[model samples]
Target: MHKQRLVIAGSGSTYTMGMMMSLIEEKENFPLKEVVFYDIDEQRQERNAKATEILFKERYPELESFSYTTNKEIAFKDADFVFVQIRTGGLPMREKDEQISLKHGVVGQETCGPGGMAYGLRSIKDMIELVNDIRTYAPHAWILNYTNPAAIVAVALKQEFPDDHRLLNICDMPIAIMISYAKMLNIDVWEIVPEYFGLNHFGWFTKIYDKSGNDHTERLKSRIIDEGFTPEDTEIANDVSWQKTFEQARQMLMDFPEYLPNTYLQYYLYPDQMVEKEDPERTRARQVIEGRQNRVHSLCDGIIEKGTAKDADLHVDIHGVFMVKAAASLAYNLNERFIVITENNGIISNLPEDAMVEVPALLTANGPKPFAIGEIPTFYKGLIEGQYAYEKLVTEAYFENSYQKLVQALTLNRTVISPDKAKAILEDMMEANASYWPELN
Candidate 1:
C-alpha cells in the first residue's frame, strides 16, 4: 500500500478536529504518510495546530508525520489529495451577508438567497486561487472541494477549468439527509442507494432502493407527507434549528408530492415563511458563532492548556467524515456512488448543458462519472432553471465585476420580489463586503 500525503486547506476551521479524527479512524484503509494543515489566520491556526498535535500524539502514535503551516508551497507540495473547505470572509462577514439581506425582506441564509450570492462572489476568487496553487504545486493531486455556496463555486470552477478532471466539488447535506432517511426506514444508511438530482441545496430524491432492490420511494414519501422528515435518531437532527428544517420537509412534500425535497428548498418555495422565522438581530451566523464557534475554540484552548486531548470533549462531525470517504474512494478507486456537483452536459435533458447539477456519480481514480437523470418534471425544471440562472449570473458578476449583473442576479432570486429591493440589498451587501468582494462597475 502506498502511503499518501494529504493537505487540508482551511485547517483552522472548527470542523478540522472532526476531519482529523476521521482520518485517524480510517487510517488502515487510507494510510497517510504525511498530513499538512494550512490556514491564513495565524492565531486560530496555531490553536488548532496545538490541538492537532495533542490528538495525534495521544490517539494515533503510529501516524508517520503531521504539521501545520501558513506556507502554501510547503502545504501543497507532493500532496496526493487536497481537501478545500475555506470560508472567504469567515463568520463576521457571513453575519453581515445575512443581516443585510434580512433588512431588505429576503431570506437570510448562509447558502441561499442574497446571502449566498454575496458569499459566492467572495468564494469564487479564493477558490480560483486555491485551485491555481494546487495545480502549480501538486499537478496530479485530486482536489476534493467541500466549499460552501458549492453550487456557485462549482459553476465558477467549471467555467475557469473546464478540462480539469481532478477537481471534484461536493457537499455533505445530501449525506446528512440520507442519514435521516436511513433512521426513518430503520436501516443502515449504506444499505440504501438514492436517485437524486438538482443544484446544490435545491434538489430532490426521486428514488431510494434498498440492498434487495426494493424501491422505497413511495413508502418514504408517504411517511414524509404524514409525519414530516422526522428521523428516529440522527446527530444532525439534534439541533432545534435542524429539527425544524427536517420537519419543514412536510410542507415541501405537501406542495409537491412527486418527490422528496431538500430542506433548503424551504427558503426558495416559502421565502415568506423563512423571513417570518428569521430574527434579523440574531441570524444563523450569530447562532453558529455563539454555539459551535465558542465551543470549538474553548475546546482548543483546553487542549493547549492540558497538552493532551485524552480527556477532551471533542465530537465527531459525521458530515466531515463523508469527505474522507470520498477521498478514499478516489484514491483506491472504490467506485462508490455519491452525489457530486458537476456540469450537467445533458444529464438532465430539460436543463442547460452548462449548468452545474448535483447528482449521483461513481467515484473513480479518474474522478466522478455522473449518472444521467434524464428529464425532470416541468415544475422542478422551472425552479432549477431559475436558480441556475442566479448562480451562473453570480459567477459572471464576479468575473466581469459587473454591478448590473450583480443586481440582476439578486432580482432573479426567489426571495427578492422587485428590482428596487434587489438594488437595496445589493448596495448594503456591497458596502458590508467592501473588503472582500471585487469592485463592481
Candidate 2:
C-alpha cells in the first residue's frame, strides 16, 4: 500500500491534538508520508501545529514532512485524505447561536434547533467553498468531514455535488454513546456491532449485538433506565448540561421504548425542559471554551514552553479514535463498519431518497456503502421526515437566500414548532449572524 499524505483542515480545533494521537495509534494500518495542518486562523493553528510537530518528532518520527499553513493550496496539494473539522464562526459565534435562541424562549443547542439552523447556514457556505478548493487542489483525495451541523452540511453538499463519492460526512456522537454502552455492558466497544438509523444527531440505535451475535439492545436499554446514563468521556461528565443530556436519554427511552434514542434528541423531544434548564448567561459553547478549549491549548502551550512533548497529557478519546478509524478503513480498504451520514437513496424505504440520513455503513475505498434499513415505524418515520424537511429547507434557504424558507425550516424544527417563535428567533439570529450568513431576502 502506498503511504498517504493527510491534511487536517481545522488544525486549530480543540480536537486536533486528539486526532493526532489517534493517527499515531493507527499508524500501522494507515501509514502516513506527510501531515499538513490547514486553518484560516494562523495563530491558533500554529499553536497546535508547533505542539504537534514536537510530539511527532518524539513519538512518530517516521513522517517525512509536517507543516501547517493558512494557504489552501499548500495544505491540500496532492493530499490523499483530508480530515475536515472546521468551525466557520468559531466558539464566539456559536455562543451567539445558543444565547439568541435562549433569549427567545426556545431550546438553544449547537446542532439541533434554531442554533443548528443558524450554524448550518454559515457552515454550508464555507463547506461548499472548501469542497471546491479540495477538488481544485487534490481531485482524487477522499474528504472525510467531521464538521458540526453535519446533517445540514451533508444535505447542502449533496445538493451541490450529488455524484461526488469521495466525500463522506460522519458524526462521532453514536460512537461516543456506544462507548458508554460498552462500559455499561462490561465489554470493549469494538465487540458490539450496532444497527442504527436516523438523521445526524436525531437518530436511534435499533439493536446492538455482541460478536457472538447475542442481542444486548434490551439489556443495555434496561441498564440505562435502571441506573441512568452518562458519556464515557470524563470531560463531558464534568459539564452539568451534558450530564442532563445523558440522563434525558433515559427519560426518552422510558417514554418510547422501541429503540434507544440519541442523546441530542433531548433538544427536540423535550424542548421546554432543555430551555428552562439552560442558563442564558452560560451555554454549552461557553462551557466548552472555558473548559476543553482552555485545557487543550494550555497543554499545547506547556509542551511548547518546555520545548518537548515527553510529558504531554493529551488523551485519545472517542472523537480522535473514531476519525482515524474511519479514515484508515478507506485508506487501507479495511471495510470497517461505522455509522455515517450519507445519501438515503431508499436506504430508509419511507424517507426521501435524496435526504442525507445516518445509518450503518461499511467504510470502503469507494466510500460509505450504507445498509438498507427497509422501513421504519410510523413514529420514527414521522419524526425523521419532519427533521429531514427542516434540513432540506435550511439547505434551500442558504442557496436561494430566501428568508421565508428559513422561517419554514425553523418552524418545522421540533424545538421551534410555532411560526411566531421561529420568526422571533430567526430575526434575532439574522441580526447576530449578519456578518457570517448571506443576506437573506
Candidate 3:
C-alpha cells in the first residue's frame, strides 16, 4: 500500500485545525503515510500544531505521525494530497467585502456577494502558488481545493491547469442538498440516483431515480407545488418550509422544466432580488457575526495568550473526513461519485471548452471525467461566457501584473455597477488588503 503524504495548506484555520484533530481521533479514516500541515503564518499555525501534537500524543499515538511547517517545499514535496481552505483577506477583509457591496446596493453575503468577487482576486494568486508548489514538490499530488469563492477559484484552476486532474475542487453543499432530497423521498441519499448539474451553488436537480428505477422527483414536486396549499404559512424557515435551496429549486421548476436551481445561482440569477434587512432564517453572515466570529477569535486568542492546550477542548471535527476521504478514494481508485470542479472538456456542451464546471464526476487513476449535462438554461448560457472572461482575465492579470486586466475582472463581476465603481471597489479593496494582494502595479 502506498502511504499518502497529505499536506493541508491553510493549517492555521480553525476549520483546518478541527479537521486535523478529527483525523487524530478517527485513526481509521486518516491512514496517511504522513500528515503535513502547511501555512505561512507561523505565529498562528504553531498553536494549532501544538494542539494537534498533544491530541495525537494522548490518543492516536500509533498513527504514522504528523509534521507542521511554513516551508511549502519541505511540507508539500512528495505529497499525495493537499487540502486548501484559505480566506485570502481573512476576517477584516470579509467584513470589508460585505460593507462595500452593501454600500453599492448589492446583497452582501461573504461567500456570495461582491466580497466573494474581491476574495476571488486574491484567491487566484493563492491558487497559482499552490499550483507552483505542486510543480516544485508533489507533481503527482491531487489538490482538494475547499477555498471560498469555489466557483471562481475552480474556473481559474481549470484554465491554468487544463491537464492537471491532480487538482480537484469540491464543496459540501451538494452533499447536504442530496441528503435533503433523500429525506423528501423517504430513502437514504446513497440509495437515490440524482442526476444534477450547475456552475457551483447555482445549478439544479434534473433527473431523479433510484438504482432500482424509482422516480423520486414526482413525490418531491407534488409536496412543494402547494398541492395542499397552506394559508397561514409565510415563514421560510418553518420545519415544513423548505431550505433556501428547495425554495430556489421550486422556482426553477417553472421555466427550466428539466432542472431545479441551487442557492449559489441566486447570486447570478437575482442580482437585484431584495433579501430582507433582517432575515428571520439562518444566514451564514449572521451566524459569523453572532457566533463563529467570537468563537474563532477566542480560540485564536486562547492559543496566542496561553501557549498551551490547558483550555483547549476536543471538538468533534469532520472537515478532515472531507479532505482525506477524497484523496483516499483517488489513491485506492474507488471512482466514487464526487461533486468536483474540473474543466468542461465537453461535459457541458454549451459552456466554453475551458470553463470550470461543477458536476458529478468519478475519480480514477487518470482523473475526473464528468458526465454530460446536455445544455444549461439560456440565462446560464449568457452567464457562463461573461463570468469565464473575468475568471480567466483576472488570473492572467495577477500572473502578469496587468492592472487593466484586474480592473476588467472586477467590472465583469456583474455585481459591480460601472467601470468607475469598479475602480473604486478594486482600489479600495486592494488598499484595504495590501497585506494580501500587494502585487498591484
The per-model lDDT (C-alpha) reads 0.88, 0.91, 0.67
Error of 1 at 394 (Å): 0.9
Better of 2 and 3 by TM-score: 2
Model 2, 29-131: lDDT tens digits are: 8889999999999999999999999999988999899999999999889999999999999999999999999998998889989999999999999999999
Where does the lowest 10-residue lDDT sum fall in candidate 3? 228-237
RMSD of each: 1.4, 1.0, 5.2
Per-prediction TM-score, please? 0.97, 0.98, 0.81
In order of lDDT, best first, we have 2, 1, 3
Error of 1 at 241 (Å): 1.3
Off by over 4 Å in 3: 21-30, 57-59, 224-258, 274-290, 296-320, 396-424, 438-441
Residue pairs clashing, model 1 = none
Tens-digit lDDT track of model 1 for 1-441: 778899999988878887888888888888888889999887888888889988998877887898999999999988999999999999998998999888888899999989999999989999999999999999999999989999999999999999999999999888888887887788988788999999999999999998799998888888777766764333455567888888888888887888888889999999999999989888999988888788889989999998889889876566667888888899999999888898899999999999999999999988889898998999899999999999999999999999999888888889885899988888889888888899999
Per lDDT, the best of the predicted structures is 2
lDDT of 3 at 252: 51
Task: Pick the winner on TM-score between candidates 1 and 2.
Answer: 2
